[model samples]
Target: MTTSLTIAQAAEATGLSVHTLRYYERIGLLDPVERRDNRHRRYTQEDLNWIDFLKKLKATGLPVRAMLHYAELRREGNTLESVIERKAMLQAHTLCVQHTLAELQENLAVLQRKLVLYDELEQAARAAGARAPRNSAPTPPTPERMAP
Candidate 1:
């Protein structure tokens, strides 16, 4: 028999707050949850799996509207058209994520180069027998100055 968890248990297992889970259902990001006779939600393992997938999408910075659209498509069942659309959406999102990662790497390289420059400057000053004051470190470059 499939095990079921209460709403509180589902929230703890998914690392999402109960309020967020309710909000997700209300906003149509999630399908209506099953309920016990007392009207309390009873989440199945399938629901937990879906929630995990949702979390993955959220981690990828997929906007809520896009996620909602994906959920709608998903609920339409695995028809060929829905499958194609989902694949297309994921491909576009993947490209966007790749671009963002590239930009972050470039920014990280700049910061690393700046640190190296500071180290070289400090070493040269020490070699010249001058004690650079703690407050003598150069100010961080502004965006205008950061341009190559």
Candidate 2:
């Protein structure tokens, strides 16, 4: 027999807060979890595996709406149309992730260039006899600079 996990155990296994797990169910990201006769939720290995994939999607920057749509399609049962749609969505998401990685790489290069500029600015200011600000790093990287 397959051993079932308690909600607490699921949370620990998935590195998700208990509240987040409940929220996932509420948002339809997860199908309604099975419950024991006394009303405690019992999760199976399948559930754990699904949650792991969800985490990967999230980490890769898939939005909630897209994930929700994927879940809805998955719950529609095993039909050829549904499988095709799921494949299409996953392919689209893969392209989106690739774009994001490219953007992140470009943004990082801009940040590095800006840092070098700041260092030069600091040195120039010091050469002219004024102390430059000690910590002038930008808050975060963004692809705002126009690429040449």
Candidate 3:
């Protein structure tokens, strides 16, 4: 069995498209690719690992350039402080995303409550020999007319 994989095979393994792989290389997101016969791109196990790291960075919502910076630092060789700094950046971003998610959840709960209230109102309207569609717009508050 061959140790290296073709571009298409690498893309499938990495969950990225062949075009994305090419773009990654072109944009310096990936290190220079090793080619066989100067034509076919072949990926080694290291490349696969790099792709995996890139995927994790993407999942964490890091921008491509931010990931590229991390990749560049990583390629420079392992350093304790650099790793710490990168981890800090990711952690901060994760905290921010979690906060946003919590806010959205709260908003959703409020909207659900409003929806339930609307449903009750609709039922009451039906019982009173009045008819209106569910989710009908609420009346807008009007300003009192100014005395002449």
Q: Which predicted model would earn the best lDDT?
A: 1
Which of candidates 1 and 2 reaches a greater TM-score? 1
Expressed as tens digits, the lDDT of each residue in 18-136 for candidate 3 is: 99999999988899888998799999999999889788778767788788887777777668878887778778878977987899899999989998999999899989989766888
In candidate 1, position 122 carries an lDDT of 82
Q: Write the per-residue lDDT of candidate 1 for residues 73-133, one digit (tens) a residue.
A: 9999999999999999999999999998999999999989999998899899989998867
Clash counts per candidate, in order, are 0, 0, 0
Worst 10 residues of 3 by lDDT: 139-148
lDDT digits (tens) for residues 1-148 of candidate 2: 8899999999999999999999999999999999999999999999999999999999998899999999999999769988999999899989999999999999999989998999899799889999646797556645576445
Which residue pairs show collisions in model 1? none
TM-score of 3: 0.68
- Candidate 1 positional error at 58, Å: 1.7
TM-score between model 2 and native: 0.74
Candidate 1 local Cα displacement, residue 12, angstroms? 1.4
- Candidate 1 Cα outliers beyond 4 Å, as residue runs: 132-148
TM-score of each: 0.84, 0.74, 0.68
